[model samples]
Target: MGHRFPAIVVLGWVLAAAALSLLVTPLGTVVERSSTAFLPEDSPTLQGLRVMDTAFGSGDTQSYVFVVITDDDGLGDGERRVYADLVSTLEDEPERVSEVQDYLGQPQARRSMTSKDGQATYLVVGLRSAVGSPASDEDVKWLRSAVEDLDAPPGTEVHVTGDPAMISDLTTAVNEASLKITAVSLFLLVGILWLVYRRVTTVLVSLVTIGVALLCTRGALAWAGEQGLALSTYTDAFVVAITLGAGTDYCVFLISRFREEYGNGLEPLDAVAEAVSRGGVRCSV
Candidate 1:
């Protein structure tokens, strides 16, 4: 009974961790994927990118701005020809280009918002995929090349920016950071436990308990996924923190009581039994 107390506490911790993760992670994923009443929808710029993901069956999208040089005073013949040719070229690549709306020619909102001097025009281009898509890099490269090839009046510059690429980059960075933090936290925890106990065996036992709890939590996440749950990146960290803290706390209580009895000259086995009897009662309460 004494030896089993720690195991039972660890198992309970595992079960609790698994339950919490299963309940919360999927909800987080859904919130991230769709807007709720409390949270506003993605901005129009972001919506455009999402539309590309829907249209192309790819999880990528981009928003681009193409600027062209016009006469110093206003729109000129040279600028008109350059703009027309740019539109024609973009139209030729329909698959790569999802939509192109030129302020110069389209009936878009706030037409007056285009550069009043007419020296530069804005063309909003939406890509059908995000940066992670197989053809995204190629698409960006082609856009750059096309912009370079354009016979603009002069001083024209093309700029591209959007939510899909930014979000993907941010997500990757966050994942790396989370992994580093988890690794460091685990190492520090074990080191602290070993230092406090000054016994390799005790430290190992505690670590094993933690490991079991983690596995249980991860298994729950996997099961959630199988049930069509979309987990967010934070779920793993939440599970790890909860499981480790609770498992280690339970193990510490049992181990401390056992050590106290052993110090009082009781046999190792007797001390373990007493520790379990007391710890089990406390844990149940």
Candidate 2:
């Protein structure tokens, strides 16, 4: 199609990419970052989670995180206020935090959450959103920021971790790595391609093809996810690496084939048709 009506094909792909980024379900939305997400859908834990989400709502599900506060001197009255205040603060954000376990009044629960050294305690925070969902990740980030801003006694330190925190942190890391990997891959591919081709047009063509493939793969995955498929958060980073490597390799082969055909006195369009038709299976392999 590109060889026949290049302008129309280019315009169509441009529109497709724009629509993919703007209109489609975001790539992150369908990616699951939790360990449970890696479990089989029929796993007892996952089944229970689905049942809980369906019956009691995701807010009341078993999706929870811990906020641990510690001090070398132990949790004194001053530190108690910090914990109380932190719970109250999280409680206020109903949209982010669904349930906050307070050990302030429950002596039994307090003992359970308290460290043997009496210097640390943790809160079991039930998220208002499903695990690995965007809503849940946002909730963890907000909770972390809130913990950091709390006024605590000297030698006191606070941290957020556990199931929910793992999902949130891993998701954020995957996203950051995807962007970094893509940028670095582009830089390296451009340098290497330019060195190999020594032609600006050929270099740009290779990159353009790669960019289109990247957009299409992301779009296709998001689309499949909407149809009840889910992928790991790390898939994006892996996809970026494979797409660039394979896409560039395929382009190199096609260009080489075209040069070979055109050198034999074939016309430009004929050369492209010959390259594509003959290179199809081999380019993919």
Tens digits of lDDT, candidate 1, 67-136: 4344556666766677677778887987887667665564574255457655555566667544433245
Write down the TM-score of every candidate.
Answer: 0.50, 0.77
lDDT of 2 by residue, 1-285 (tens): 667786887799878887887787777656642212434557797678768766765435547788999999878988889999998898787766667777876778988889899999988787756566656666778888898899988899999997778977877887888788888988989998898899999999898888988898888777777777757656667877899999988898889999999999998987877898887553221
Candidate 1 residue 19 Cα shift, in angstroms, is: 18
Model 1 stretches with alpha carbons more than 4 Å out: 1-98, 104-160, 257-285
lDDT of each: 0.62, 0.78
Error of 2 at 134 (Å): 0.5
- The regions of model 2 sitting more than 4 angstroms off are 1-42, 48-59, 93-96, 215-239, 281-285
